[model samples]
Target: MDSSAKPILVTGGTGYVGGRLIPRLLAGGHRVRALARSPERLHCRPWGGHARLEIAAGDALDRDAFVRAARGCGAAYYLIHSMNAHKGRFADADRRAADNMVAAARQNHLSRIIYLGGLGQQNHEALSHHLKSRHEVERILQAGPAPVTNLRAAMILGSGSASFEMLRYLVDRLPVMITPRWVRTPCQPIAIGNVLDYLQGCLGVDQTVGQTFDIGGPDILTYRDLIHMYAREAGLRQRLIIPVPVLTPWLSAKWVHLVTPVPASIAQPLAEGLSIPVVCRDHRIRNLVPVTIMDARQTIRNALARIRQEQVDTCWFDGGGSLPPEWTTCGDADYAGGTVLGGAHRIVLEGDARLVWSTVRTIGGKNGWYFAQSLWRLRGLLDRMVGGPGLRRGRRHPSDLRVGDGLDFWRVIALDPPKRLLLLAEMKTPGDALLEFMISPQGTDKVELKMISRFLPRGLAGILYWYALLPTHRWLFEGMLRAVARKTGLPVTHGPEKAAMTSALECRL
Candidate 1:
C-alpha cells in the first residue's frame, strides 16, 4: 500500500498516544480509521468531528470485530496495551490481543503494522513484566505476514503523558522525598513530539519496514536528574532525594499511588520498569526519519509551556478502560436516582434561572470558585499531592459546559441549562462522586437553587472518608450556595434572618 491510498487503522483511538496521533494524521492529509472499545468516548475528542476520520467501535480481543475495523485499511497501528486493564492476567490478555490483531491484519490484507514499545537493552528474561510485555507484543507483530515497524521509547516528556504526569506531580508535591533505587537509574527520555514524528515518518516509508529502532532524546539523564530539571523548569526549589534500596516495586507503586494521579495498579508496572536502564542503543532512526530530537531540558520546558497555556490536547486520563469495572456504571449517574451519601443544600434567590445557570457555568476555571478561592486552591493542591489532575485542566471554554468536558478535575456528565448541571469527580478519591446543581423557578422573580453532592463509597475507607469530611462539606456547600445566590443579586441572611427568608421563599413555592 502507498502513503496516499487507503485509511490507516489506529487501534487505541482513545488512548494517550493514539488520541493525539489521530489529529496529526488528519492534519497530514491521511484518512484515519480509529478502532475503540467505546465509540461514545471518542466523541469527546477535539478531533472526533474531523471529516477525514472514521471511528470503528469494537474490542481488539474480538476477532470478528477486529477484522471489521481493519478491513479497509492499508496499514494498522497496534497501540493497545492491557497493563492498566484491571484484568490480573494482563500479559496473557496482551498476547491474545496481539494475536487477534495479527489475524485481523493478515485477513484484511494489510501492508504493514507499526507499534510503539518500551525501550530497554536488558535481556528479555531479566526485563520487567511491563517492558517484556511490550517486547512480546513487538515479536508477535513481527511474526505476522506483514512487516512491522517497531519504535521503542522510554519516558515520554509531555503535559499529558503518564510518565511526565507522574514526574510532574512528584516534583511539585514533595520537597524532600525518600525515593526508590531507580531514582538514580540512567535513562534516555524522549519528547512526545519526536515520538509522534517517528510514528508518522514510518508510515509507508520503505526503509522503516521490517526494522526496529530505539528512540530517545538528544541527551541522557538519571531519573533524579529528570526530577531536578523538572523542578528548575517549573521554578520550584531543588528537591532533596534520598534513594532507598528497601522500597520494593509494590511499595514504590503504593508511594507513587499516594503522591500522583496514577493508581497503584498502573504505577506498579511503571515503577518496576524504572529499575532497568533505558538508554536508546540505536541511532539509525534519526538518519532515516530526518527529524530533530529535543534534549531533556528542552522537552521539559515545552511540556511546561503547554501546561501553562492549558492547551493540553490529550491526557493519560483519556483512556477509557483504566477505571475499575464497577466504576464504569457510574456513567449512568444521570439516570440513577438519589444521593447515596453527601450533602444537599438549597437557596431561594430573586433572579432569572438563566442568569443563575450562567453563574453556575462560570464556577470553575479562570472565574474561580465563587465562595473561597484560596480554599479551592488548597483543595486542588492537596488533590495534586495525591496524584490528581488538580486544577490544571480547567474548563475547555470559559462559559461553556458540555457532557464529558473536563472542568478542573471534574467531568461534566449532565448539562441542562437553567435546570440542571451535573459533574463527576475525576480526582483521585476513595469513592465515586457526583455533584449536581439545579435551578428551578419557584414563581416570578424567585428561583430555587439546589446543590447536591453524592458519593458511592467503595468500602469502610470510603464511608469513613465521607463522614470525616461531613463538617467541611456543610461549611463549603452551604457557603457556595449562598455565594451563588449573592452572585445572582439575591439577599443574604443568617440565623433568624435566614429563617425569615426561607419562610418567604416557601410561601412563593
Candidate 2:
C-alpha cells in the first residue's frame, strides 16, 4: 500500500503526541485529517495552516461525528485518553471512546487503527487503573472489524511530555525530598523521538498491522535513577531522597500537585501507576522498525537542549485546565457572574491590531509586564518566598505564545494571535484567576484593547484577597494598557473618539 496517497485520520490532534505527529506525517508526504472537539483550538498548532491537513470538528464520543471524520481515511491513530477524569470514571470513558472509534472504523471501512497504550508487565488484575485502562482501550480498538496496531510504551522522555515535565519541576524545586517506595520500581522508558520513529515506520508495514509491540529505550532504570539523572544533566546538586513505605499513591499525588505544575487529578493516576514495573519484555519491534534508542542520560540531555533553545513543541497542558476535564469547553467567556470578581479596562489605540497583539504576546519575563516592573518583581519575590512558581520560569520564546506554554507564573490557556490571549494563574493562590486580553480591529487604522482580570475566590480568604488587591490591579492594568498602546507607537483615543472606535471594533469581530 502507498500510505501517503490516502488521507489519514489523527484523533486527539491537540494533545502532546498528536500535535507533534501531524507535522511529521505531513513532512512524510501524507494527506492528514485531524478530528478535534473544537477545530479552532487546533489553530494554535504550528502546522495549523498546512495545505495537506484537514480539520474535522466533532466529539469522539459521538459515533456519527467519529464516523464522519473517519470517512475516506486509510488509517487512524487513537491517541486519546482522559488523564483529567475522576478516578472512578476514566476507565469507563476510555472504553466507550474506544468502542466509538471501532464502530466508526468499521462503518467507514478504514484499513487499520493505530493506538498508543501503556507499557507494563502486570496483568489486568495487578495493573493500576491508569495502565489497565490503556490496555483496555487497545483491546477495544482491536475488537472491531479493522486491524489495530497497538504500541505500548512506558515513560516518554521529552521536553514537554507529562512525565518529563513532572520530573523537571520536582527535581528543580526540591533539594531534600520524601518519596514513596514505588520510586524504586524498575522500568524501561523510551525517548519521544524514537517513539515517533516507530509510529511513522509502522504506517505501511504489513507486520505492524494487528500487532502489539512493547517499545522502550536502551536503558532500564528506576524512577529514582531517572530523577537523579535529570538533576545531573541539569547541573543541579545531588538531591537527598528518603523513601517511606507508608505514603500511599494518593498522598504522593497530593505532594506532586503542590510541588509541580501538574494537578492532583492527573498526578494521582501517574503516581498509582508507578507501583507497577513497565519494562519491555522483548525487542521484537527492532526487526520491523529499526531505530536507535538513546540511554537515560542522553535522553535527558536532549530534553534539556530543547528547553534551553526554547523549542518545546507541545506541553501536557496544551489541551487546557489541569484540574477538570470539562474546563477545556469554556470558550471565550470572560464573565463569571456568581462568585467571581472581575476588573476590566478598555482603551482605543491608533495602530495596527497586529502591532498591538505583538506587544501583548511579549509581556513578562525580561520584558517585565510592560508596566509597573518593580511591583511585578516584588510580587514575584513574595510568591517565591511562599514556595510559589513566581516569575522565574520566564518563557520559552519572547514573542511566541502557544497553549500550555509557561509565561512567568502563568500558563497560556488560550492564544489567538492579533485577537485574544487568556492566561491561567499557576502561583500559590486561594482561588482561581485568569487574565485576558482581547484585541479587535477598529476600521483599518485603529484597534480596541480590552484587558480583564478575573478571580474566583475560594472562600472568605479569597474574597478578602480580591478586594485587597483591587486597587493595585486597577492601577497596574490601566497603566499596562497604556504601555501596550505606547509599544504600538500610537496615540490613545479620547472619550468621544473611544466610543467611535469601539463601534468599529465591535462590527469587525
lDDT, model 2: 0.80
TM-scores of the candidates in the order shown: 0.78, 0.82
**CA RMSD, predictions in order:** 6.2, 5.0
Model 2 per-residue lDDT tens digits across residues 1-509: 55457799999888888888999999998899999875755766678889999999888888899999988888999999888634468788888889989988888888888899988754535578788789888878878998999899988889888788889999999999899998999888889998889888899688999999999999889999988998999999999999999998888876876677566667777777778888888789899988877887898999999988878887776654333122223442433333556767788888788888888999986798988888888887677656565775566577788766678888776677879988888777888887888888888887889887767788889999898988777677778888877777889883111111121111111
- Tens-digit lDDT string for candidate 1 (203-275): 8478998899999998888889999999999999999999998998888887877677666667777777778
Top candidate when judged by lDDT against the true structure: 2
**Which 10 consecutive residues of model 1 have the lowest summed lDDT?**
500-509
| Candidate 2 RMSD computed on C-alpha atoms after optimal superposition onto the true structure | 5.0
Shift of residue 96 alpha carbon in model 1, Å: 3.0
Report the poorest 10 consecutive residues by lDDT, candidate 2.
496-505
Deviating ranges (above 4 Å) for candidate 1: 1-3, 85-87, 122-125, 321-421, 424-434, 437-479, 487-509
Clash list (residue pairs), candidate 2: none
